[model samples]
Target: MNLDELRTIMRQCGVEDGVDLDGDILDLEWQELGYDSLAVLEITTAVQHAARTPLLEEEVALLTTPRLLLERLGTLTPAAV
Candidate 1:
């Protein structure tokens, strides 16, 4: 999904900062955005659900920023999921 939608998912996953999420935050690391590894995994799962796409585990492991995740998701079609 898009960044705004991602922001929503991040919130639901317990990233408790609207100010950070509202800013130009695409490039921020997950840690800097108030998420740990566990939370990141949760976020990835939520993203896949929201997008109706299956992300590769290796690719998910490589994700560092919201932009990167979005880019990865963009490469997949529903059929590819």
Candidate 2:
């Protein structure tokens, strides 16, 4: 999905309301954003559903940032990009 959709998913998944995630956010680890394993699972599952793709749980677990997740999703489902 697009950046706005990614950000909205993050927010809905409990990211702080107005954290002002700048460009630097792309390099930050998912854990740094306060997402536990469960949160990641939920977010990735949501993304998979939204993108209409079948994302492996192991693949999602390997993603360390939103950019990485987006990139992976894009690779898995071109329509998502």
Candidate 3:
């Protein structure tokens, strides 16, 4: 998904206005933005629902930043038989 979509998902997940949306946040950790495990789960759930991609809980757990999460989502493709 695109950055706009990710931003929307984050906003829906209760990210405050204090968080910089336009600035570079790729290196920032989710916890640094005040997101706990539950918040991450909520964001991942919303992303999965929007993207119609099946994401594992472990995969979600490993996503430390928005860039990583976006990259992981970008790599999701249907397997061919």
Candidate 4:
């Protein structure tokens, strides 16, 4: 997970051109991305497949933008038990 990966994931998520990914996702509403609940769910499914992990429903809800989503996923790095 890097910015490039985040951009790609967002492209897959249907983010239109001209939207900025450098800002806070929460500041951008769902309507800005042209997404409804179903589209967001589809993006969650795509991210799960791409990342090859199970993302909790709550986690998906927090993915309002590419940057934020990647940041959250980056925090999931495996640690020694």
Candidate 5:
């Protein structure tokens, strides 16, 4: 999924809380973004809905940031430097 899709999920999950999701936030930790474990669960649930792939708990725990989450979901294309 892309940032826009993730943003949509976050908004739908009631998670972002006004943070500038459009900003450079891919590297920010979910905790830094004010997301707790429950929030993370919510996010994963939303991702599962969109991707139609259920994440194992162990796998879900590894998604620490937006970039990591996108990578784990196997949705992010490598960026050109």
Candidate 6:
């Protein structure tokens, strides 16, 4: 559910290539990130394994970026501004 955990899951899912996890996942083009529907499914699967929670379909929509995904997974706590 954390950034590190999300990154690890994404690496396992083979969607991290040519993608930048430092910023946001949703900000990038899905095609550019090498994601098709299948890849997204794979990511969702890995995310479930990593987060130990079976995400709802709607949750996937919220998982647009690594940051967003991590936020959805409750992995990333908001830091003080």
Candidate topping lDDT? 1
Please rank every candidate by lDDT, starting with the best. 1, 5, 3, 2, 6, 4
Residue 68's lDDT in candidate 5: 80
Judge candidate 1 at residue 41 and give its lDDT.
97
**What residue pairs clash in candidate 6, if any at all?**
1-75, 25-65, 26-64, 26-65
Better of 1 and 5 by lDDT: 1
Superposition TM-score, candidate 5 onto the true structure:
0.84
Could you tell me the C-alpha RMSD of candidate 5 in Å?
2.1
Worst 10-residue lDDT window, candidate 4 = 72-81
TM-score of 2: 0.78
Cα lDDT tens digits, model 4, 1-81, are 555554566667776677765554443556676677887788667777777767888888877755456556674333311
**Residue 26 lDDT, candidate 6, scale 0-100:** 41
lDDT of 5: 0.80
Could you estimate the TM-score for every candidate? 0.84, 0.78, 0.82, 0.56, 0.84, 0.66
Instruction: Kindly indicate the candidate among 2 and 4 with the higher TM-score.
Output: 2
Query: What's the CA RMSD of model 3 in angstroms?
Result: 5.7
| Model 6 Cα shift for residue 31 (angstroms) | 4.0
Per model, how many backbone clashes are there? 0, 0, 0, 0, 0, 4
- Can you write out model 6's per-residue Cα lDDT over 1-81, one digit (the tens) per residue? 666666566566675456675555544544567777777778778878766888888778756655566666666654411
Q: Provide the global lDDT of candidate 3 against the true structure.
A: 0.78
List model 5 lDDT by residue over 11-72, tens digit each: 77665567877787788898887788998899988888898877889988888988888877
What does the lDDT read for residue 38 in candidate 2?
89
Worst 10 residues of 1 by lDDT: 72-81
- Ten contiguous residues with the weakest lDDT in model 3: 72-81
